[model samples]
Target: MRHRAIQILFCLSVLATFAAAQTVVEGSVRDTSGNPVSGAELSLHHTPGNTVQSTHSAANGTFRFSGTEAGTYTLTAAAPGFFSSVHNFVLRPREPLALTIELQRQERVSEQVEVHATYQTIDPEKTGSSYTFTREDLERLPDPLLESSNDLVTNLMPGASDSHDNFLAIRGTEFSLHEFINGVSFLDNAQPQFNPGVSPQIFETVDLMTGGFTPEYGNRFGGVLDITTRSGADLGGHGDVNFRGATLDNYDINADYGGQAGALGYYLFVDGFTSGRYLDPPEPRELYDFGKGARAAAQLDWKWGSKDAVKLLLMGGGTSFQQPNITDDQLVGRDAQRHLRQETGILTWLHTFSSETLLATSVYARDGSDRVLPTTDPITPYSFASRAPFTLGVKSDLSRYWHGHFFKAGMDLVRLRELESFFFDSRGDPDVFPAFSGGLKGGQASFYVQDHFSPLPNLTADLGARYDYFDFIDTAVQLSPRVGLAYHIKKTKSVIHAAYNRYFSPPPIEYSLLASFIGHNAVDPSQRVGDVRAYTQNYFEAGWAQELRPQISLELNAYLHTGHNSFENHEISISRIFVPINFHTARSNGAELVLNLKQWDRLGITGRFQYAVARTYFYGPITGGFAGDEPLAAGERIIPAFDQTHTGTAQ
Candidate 1:
């Protein structure tokens, strides 16, 4: 492409902006092709703090950003398939800035304007690679009586579908992901899944950072899921009861764990859900849940000494979904259909080293042994698995106007292990079916460095990288790098953002399938993913942002990704090894749009849409055999099953 930009500003009148006042800015966005881009974004920025106040874009290739301050600022226009453009102007005291911004053909994308949607905006200056979830987001809106935190993960950015029961797949890696318990990796392995929060009501925030984080984080090609519990706004003890008619009935009560003595703080929370069967007069069979769900948690904090502070969190829950299953011979329930039980726990601590350096560590453990527990055949009815991982790390950050440059450094170590067991069904053609199972253990350590360079007031850039080591595989050393930049449109409110990040992902389980044939009455059945070897993923995205007004703005982003040695979740059988031989790769492309309205407080609205295709072919020899209408046709691909023809959310 070529270096190009187009900035158009339509001010209703230059004299009207004499008195500073709240105003509006509305305009149209077109391209060199003389075609109007309907979803193009318009952004307006106020001076100082640069807080994102609003966002919006209308149909007919037109956008209106209202509630802006009457100050001399800039206006920017950006769209996925166009070049970055800006409009610099002087907003006097009153009236509105009616401007038109036209973007050129595809050109280099900038950092701030890189994301096609408003939701992609993150304060990169604060953290490099972190995914945050605002508790108020529609996805977290309190559900009637949901029991498990396992299913809540699907709503997170970069999170995958629920593959195996309770089995989570992060990025392309299935089970290698790290789940945190209040910042500490799990030490117990009894939870049904890796998502740590059991009841959303107890947590105030949930963040998941896939990679490119500071040294304080541990080793793993996957990512990290962090949970923060809410603190009691009041000091006095408080309690409340939640009573409602739904699939589950809930009741809760909590107390402040500290008093006026010394310097200590803590809060306790306990709640339980009764199955419909336990209700008065009892509920119908169709709604008769086989088990009740219960959970309890506590958050504690205190000053360890003069310059140190310590915080601790405790949480646990129990849940199961039992359904009716019958065979041809008996109408009565011959097989019990159920979602089993799991346990979880976590602990974390932190100490300060003056204002420039801080030290901290966390420990997490979880056990998921909730098996079928067949009522008739109680002995080895199903499989039982557990995982425990510990993390220790330190961080040092300096904040000063030293040459107008910022720097940071950190390092961390992680230890991981898994205990698994599997059993065979008495009716599984018992002859050929083998009763087998096994477990695996591994550990790793990693470190990283980063720096943000600001040479001029209108220009900024960031660079960083990380290295990790593993024991299970040779050449364990791995590197992850990231880069970003932003350019301010002279003195205007307009700015552009573009970034590139390189992350590593573990392959599926099939790559390790050879292990099953070598075992004697012992096997893991499948590794991390759906019985497929792990595959690595390298994603690249570019987009832009615009401050159309102080209260309304918009963003446009486009991305193309490349995947090598990709693995597919396929069938597994003896003698046949694993279905779909490994060693395959592919590519994909897509775009997204986001809108925000700050004027409407009580009513919040957001929307996102994506179109991408991922495909892979059998790596093994296929000379004479026909590829057969493409094992995965363009319109027939399912890698991203949720890649709906039309996916959306509204409230």
Candidate 2:
């Protein structure tokens, strides 16, 4: 029955991709001097429908509108220091219209224009620190498609660092981050150990929030990565292809195409690559680490009517890499290999009751699996592990803006099933190494409500709460509260913000079940593990931002987190399979400084520095795997393995 449901969903997604027709409008915004005008606001008013659509010009001054009804329309473009431009045109059904609008400089600005410019420069509604990278920003990076996205984050984001085993650690927190693609959880289905690969070109925008998040987001304490995929809307049949080659026989080929036909729009991307060196090796010279992988993604949008729209996104990929072995281990011919596969699909419906009110609902499914081929070497003997996780979920969000307040509410429900197996040939050392296999079925539900409001012209506040419930090997429930505030000082061109959030993160179901099994049935009494518990945290942050000039800005922020049952992962021996462990208490504090210089005519600079301290105390016997018996002495504070005291980056 489950398989049938999935099949039906897939079929619908494919069928919906071909069903609609509408008009498209695309253009670029430029100044009188022939320079591109970035961040220009545009509005299109339809005469027949008496409706309006609004958008902002991209960094390259491009803008597009898709799925519009054939009618007479008036288009207006406005910027902070330019005179607004207006154009009137008639559109035909199933046809695309293009234009280039130019804006003229204005000597004096009105009070209203000054207010608009201030709002554009500093977002008063933002209560926390965040960084956003557009598609153009990523394209500037060298070999973006050839490297993992983690490299981008660690290099560009302040307080972000690379942890051991290809994991990302933010603000001294490791293995506790959440990744979401188009409002669906990706990390939950694909564990970090598998190192799922995604091309940067697939993303339209990547927003990383380091602190001051609202209650609407849950399940992670380190940070939140919100990603929006590319779409065909407003792109009038545009495409690109690229090929890259380097030393060591490494090569990559990638392409993307997007366009709109009538009411239907589509975007497709595919990438294939092979490399002589994949995973980082312990030795200077990589050995037995050849890797290859291919991935493809598609997005379809159908605006069947003026008030309703449907979007479908599908992605699937697989990778295979040979695990490198040390020189001594190479003598025994250790040739372990790891293979990973993942597929995700999401269908969403959007309804617009009015310009100020909207509702979006989505149904998503995800499947991920990892297999590690055993290596039979004399010293290490044999090692093997397999994991498969399936997820199905439904989510909905309603947003309404009234007066000076914006209100949002959402709910998410998910069903999870996981199958995992591990085996290690102890070679007469069964006391420490054992084989195990297990499967689990579980469900999770969450509901959240938040409000962003301006009590004063320069002061904004965000208040919200959320409820989360989880059921797998055990049941856990939490009610968390969130609060944030931002105050802008017009005289100084500065903003001060602060936030407090309570977070709840449940342990992964498969890992928790495995820990339970090991604890109950251990070959040796001393090796018995204990039950894993959910992690909870209280996070606080405060920051200040100053606009030094029109093109330069500086920011400083500090954050602290106190957590219980802190989550951690550890690999078993030399095998790549990782297990979850918990500490009794965890504390982390950090501060970061950032400087940015933008729009200097083809030149940009960014610098960041961070200092942090992280410590965990009171180790647990339960769920610690082989370290079950190694408990910390009372009053002892030890830094986490992934902690870094100081980090700095300049780009």
Candidate 3:
């Protein structure tokens, strides 16, 4: 009887151990249309232990995991051409759990779906403030192709307004915003005064980041406009042509073609427009404002095997316009013509080492030239100026997911060359402007690393650092650190976020070099041309977002920026050539409220409101070009002329 009892106890212990290790998790992947999806990558993450196990679905779209420990886990499924799906659940000992993951087809191109997924999931993890216009939102515009991209920004984005000559100002900061097309910077494309007016037809999405961005973004202080061009993936073949004629002798023509063959895809877009009222005129009756321009852009994508892909982009555009004239100038028969040209080429390669790791590298070149013809009015003849700027750069980024943490690192190296000329034709009068010509060569290097992770179930944190080196007329180096935090209150359906960021922005290349040249030449004895330095700032932000209903959401955010060497621009004595200037100290504070109502019964609405104040004290000694003699009064706070205290928009 004793032997039997011992045997029974041992058997019972063995059975219990076996049962604890028998936890089975199984899942099937399917599309929204109820069709099975094979070869989908799936990952199972143990929340408490921070362990991850990955697998792929079989031919029948079924996957299984045995011997999983009982705990809280997150399961994620990702596949090509589909939106990723995530599921969270608790596993119990000796219990078999079955799950069905339904993925939604991505309507747009598939080239950057993985990259897009990272951003789509950022709302819960990001502490920054941003606004996005998706393809669907853009399609709703009555004339997407006809409307200027700047108009969309000024009309819809809070704290954004049009500055002098179609330039954009955010939070009273002029010439501080940066523009990117398909992840490539276009900073040197054309002079700062001209807007390329890229056709909206080629845009897949537009994202505007106002403040509190990560270290991956640098060299800009006010804002960043990130645009993703459209692709032809999954589209067999399609084309569109549009033409419109309106009053004021204005007309526009746009055409686009896209298709996919085998593993390669291509998209092409071309547009031309002529407008009688291109530039805002000083008088009610527009005169000498006629303008015409043409643009062409193409994208090619190729994918091979399962781990590698390549993309090529080419773009070129040219614009010729008559500078608008004031009533007095019109009466004097004064007319000026401006011509602008820009071209860009980029090649990018992507490789995926595993389900949790991705790498991307790109090599790009951009060239731009701007010329303002000399006016022959004789009475108020203006000098002619031209600038040709070229840029070549290489950028690489690596992304990895490990142990519930998302990590990213990247580096950028850029070479810059600029050529500039000015012809005044003073006609032997020294009082008139003298002719001058010069060029500059420089380079910049930047590196950054960041990690995003959840320390608790409801709290997420992002920590990063950046290093930058600039070698131009002067050498400057900076190291910046960034931190962000987000906390979710599930019961209240709200999220509270905060961020602290240090920013370093180098001066604009063309303007900085021009300032150096002017100082060396010293056309005027009284002109005090000081050295231009990189701008530095400390930014702080806090925000709260709440979901009122399934389709309704609201967000309120406040930000403060304290910086030195704030950037400003001044026109060169009515010549329309802008030069960079700076302030000794600058401070900006603002609050914004945004309300979004998703498509409910086919009706969607978005509303935004902002209140801001921007002030600067003491003009920097580095005033350049036309502003060489700007007064430098110490400790005098001056409100920026472009500051708009209150702005509201609804759509």
Q: What TM-score fits each model?
A: 0.59, 0.82, 0.79
Which of candidates 2 and 3 reaches a greater lDDT? 2
lDDT of 3 at 61: 88
lDDT of 1 by residue, 1-651 (tens): 000000000121121111111234555677767567777666665432243233444565666553333333556667676766766443421122335466776564453344222211322132123334433442334453234444445444343334433344444433434554344443222124222336756654555554334333333334465555544433345545555445444333332232223566666777666553321211223332344556777765555463454544555555554432223212433333333334443444444443223344444334333333333433312322222222222222222112334444544444544343333353442223343344445555656666656556556666677666653322245687766665656344555656666554432222132222222122222221122232445655554555554434444444554554443333222111112223345444444343433223345534332221222222321111112122432223334322222222222
C-alpha lDDT (0 to 100) for residue 280 of candidate 3: 60
Stretches > 4 Å off in candidate 3: 1-122, 144-146, 189-192, 281-285, 425-434, 520-526, 602-626
- The residue ranges of model 2 lying beyond 4 angstroms of the native Cα positions read 1-8, 11-122, 187-192, 283-285, 428-431, 602-629
Candidate 2 vs. truth: CA RMSD? 8.1
Model 3: what TM-score? 0.79
Task: Please give, for residues 1-651, the per-residue lDDT of candidate 3 as tens digits.
Answer: 112322332343333211001235665899988789999999888643344468899888888764443445678899988988877554532223556688888888844554212101124544677766655557666573335666676765667766546667776566666766655665541222555656666766666677767777667767776666666663459888988888876888988898899889999989998888776654567878888889998888777786666666777788898877888778988788889877777665667666566676667777777888878888765679888777777677776666656677888888887788886654443434456788878889999998877789878788899999988767889999999898878678788999999988887665566655554555675554555667788989998888776545678888888888777775555565666766777788888787765444355554344443444333444443334545455555666666767777666
Query: Best-fitting candidate, measured by TM-score?
Result: 2
lDDT measured at residue 417 in model 1 versus the true structure, 0 to 100: 41
C-alpha root-mean-square deviation, each candidate:
16.7, 8.1, 15.8
Q: 1-651 in candidate 2: lDDT tens per residue? A: 224335646765555321122335667899878799999999988643344588999898988765454445678889988877876554432223456688877766652332212112334346888766656556666784326567666776677766654566777666655666666664362233564656667876666678887766667767766666767664569898989999875888888899999889899999898888776665677777788988899998777666787777887778888887778768778888888887777786767666556676667887777898988566665788888878877777776666545677888888888788888775554325667888888888999998877788778898999999988666889999999999988789898999999988887454556666665666667655466667888989999988776646778888888877776666666776667676767788888887765334345553333343433333433334334445555445677677777787766
